[model samples]
Target: MDWIVITVLFFILGLSAILIIGTLVSLPQVGDERKNLIKMKAQSYTFAVAMGYVLIQLFKNIYNGSNEGINPFTFLITISIIYLISLLFFRKKYGS
Candidate 1:
């Protein structure tokens, strides 16, 4: 609930929006199969990144014995940022 966290969340969310919108606008009309493949690859990469972040946070919390707890909003924002970046990466890497 800190102001810094809130600010960061908004900033990252804005970046995500820009990336998604820019990618959508810039992308050429591709086939559905290609689109689906890009999406699948992005999602797979995002899932792995999300799991890694969560596990690291979990262990850090346990090891530190802190009651600060994990911030759900931060987690969501992190995942969204990762997913968007991954999506864009795949699109650019595989686009014709």
Candidate 2:
């Protein structure tokens, strides 16, 4: 029942909610070109998220050898935020 644990759970649930909502939303009928563009954007964002995870792991390995002074919860939150922001930005740029 620690506050940190609660916060992390909340963030995880919030992210899950957002993703579920996004998937459930209807896409506009667009031309093939626009659809391709959106697909490319989604792929790029997915790559960004993967890279972010790798970089975060590398950081944790280098700086937290003793596993002190580093909070993994914060890193998870940061990754989630990065993913959400990129998703929103890509959707805005290509979804319209």
Candidate 3:
């Protein structure tokens, strides 16, 4: 198997586990308001980034005149990784 495939799979699995754990166990020290802010901001950014990624992929495919399709899992993992990082950033920035 190619290293790229292996790396992508590893990241998808590892990030998923971290996301699930993060969701199940909310940060201990943050207040509800701050947590909400963090979630909302992260989600907003994730949405924008995901849409941009889609557009870029669409344009690339069109320009290349290829029939290739975007991998849904790859898209999910990309933006979820972004969301998770943004979540951590906001948590630290707004955290006590």
What lDDT, from 0 to 1, does candidate 1 have?
0.81
For candidate 2, the per-residue lDDT at 54 reads 70
User: On residues 1-96, what C-alpha lDDT tens digit does candidate 2 reach at each position?
Assistant: 698888867778588658735732533466767655655676588678767777777788788674444455665565556555665566677776
In candidate 1, what are the lDDT values of residues 1-96, reduced to their tens digit? Answer: 689878988898788778777776676576878777888898899999888887888899889997576677777777887888888888888888
- Local distance difference test, each candidate: 0.81, 0.63, 0.76
Clashing pairs in 2: none
- The model with the greatest TM-score is 3
Off by over 4 Å in 1: 1-8, 21-26
lDDT of 3 by residue, 1-96 (tens): 689897877788686768846752675444777767777887798889888988999999999999898887667677767878877777677665
Error of 3 at 54 (Å): 0.3
If both were scored by TM-score, which would come out higher, candidate 1 or candidate 3?
Answer: 3
Highest lDDT: which candidate?
A: 1
Q: What is the lDDT of residue 59 in candidate 2?
A: 89
Worst 10 residues of 1 by lDDT: 21-30
What's the residue-level lDDT of 45 in candidate 1? 95
Per-residue error for 32 in candidate 1, Å, reads 0.7
Each model's backbone clash number: 0, 0, 0
